[model samples]
Target: MLAALRVGPRRRRRLRAAIGGISDKVLTDCLHRLLASGLIERHAHAGAPPRVDYALTGSGQSLIDGPMTALGRWAVEHGDELLEAQESSSAKGL
Candidate 1:
């Protein structure tokens, strides 16, 4: 999501490349979800070959700058600990 914002308006193909490891169906679903939530705007230009672009709305930008930033900071602070806990649990088969 942040990557998309950093790049500004992007077509679906660019989004897919920026956000790797996701299936086409998954990316389509996510884009729809974001659109439904009003966090992103979709613009379609009429032409011989249709052009579509996606960009983050003001609300989405605020979310990325606020809660998301805090979440990222928290992850940076405790990610190692969380990974260790997950590894221990997996080793114990629980």
Candidate 2:
């Protein structure tokens, strides 16, 4: 969820896809955790459209900015291996 928000704030659909099949239930739980920790804010706006959005709070942004750099570097190094493992597991029907 933190990773989802770290990328950017968007509607639930966008976040769901960005997080790569994070079940709505799990995403909601993660969102609640972040919100409770004061790391994120969920909002609803006025007007008939009822615009809804999510964004990282100041603390959340600060937290994500630093760790994401490190995580990204790690991902760059090990990402292909992880993806291959996932594919293998999926192919084995795990």
Candidate 3:
């Protein structure tokens, strides 16, 4: 979710599209959690039809720029090895 919001603010619909296969309930729950954690901000617009946008907060951006970046690099470096291990374990019925 954080990664999806990294680009900029997004509406609920856009978020749903960005994150494929996430149910509405799960998305709502995650948005609520992020809001509570101060990692994201929700903006409600006033008009004929209501609109809300979610954007990453400063702290959230920091998290992505720091720890998340490292984690992504680690995944790229070891993804093949991890997949091989998983396949081996599944074959062994472990």
What TM-score against the true fold does each predicted structure earn? 0.86, 0.68, 0.93
Off by over 4 Å in 1: none
Candidate 1 residue lDDT tens string, 1-94: 5556655889989898888888999998999999999999999999989999999999888888899889989999999999999999999999
Candidate 3: give the clashing pairs.
none
Worst 10 residues of 3 by lDDT: 46-55
Compare the candidates by lDDT and give the number of the best one: 3
In the range 1-94, model 3's lDDT, one tens digit per residue, is 9999999999999999999999999999999999999999999999979899999999999999999999999999999999999999999999
Question: What do the candidate models score in CA lDDT, each in turn?
Answer: 0.88, 0.84, 0.97
Q: What does candidate 3 score in Cα RMSD to the true structure? A: 1.0
Give stretches of model 2 more than 4 Å off.
74-94
Q: lDDT value for candidate 3?
A: 0.97
Residue 33 Cα positional deviation in candidate 3, in Å, after optimal superposition: 0.5
TM-score of 3: 0.93
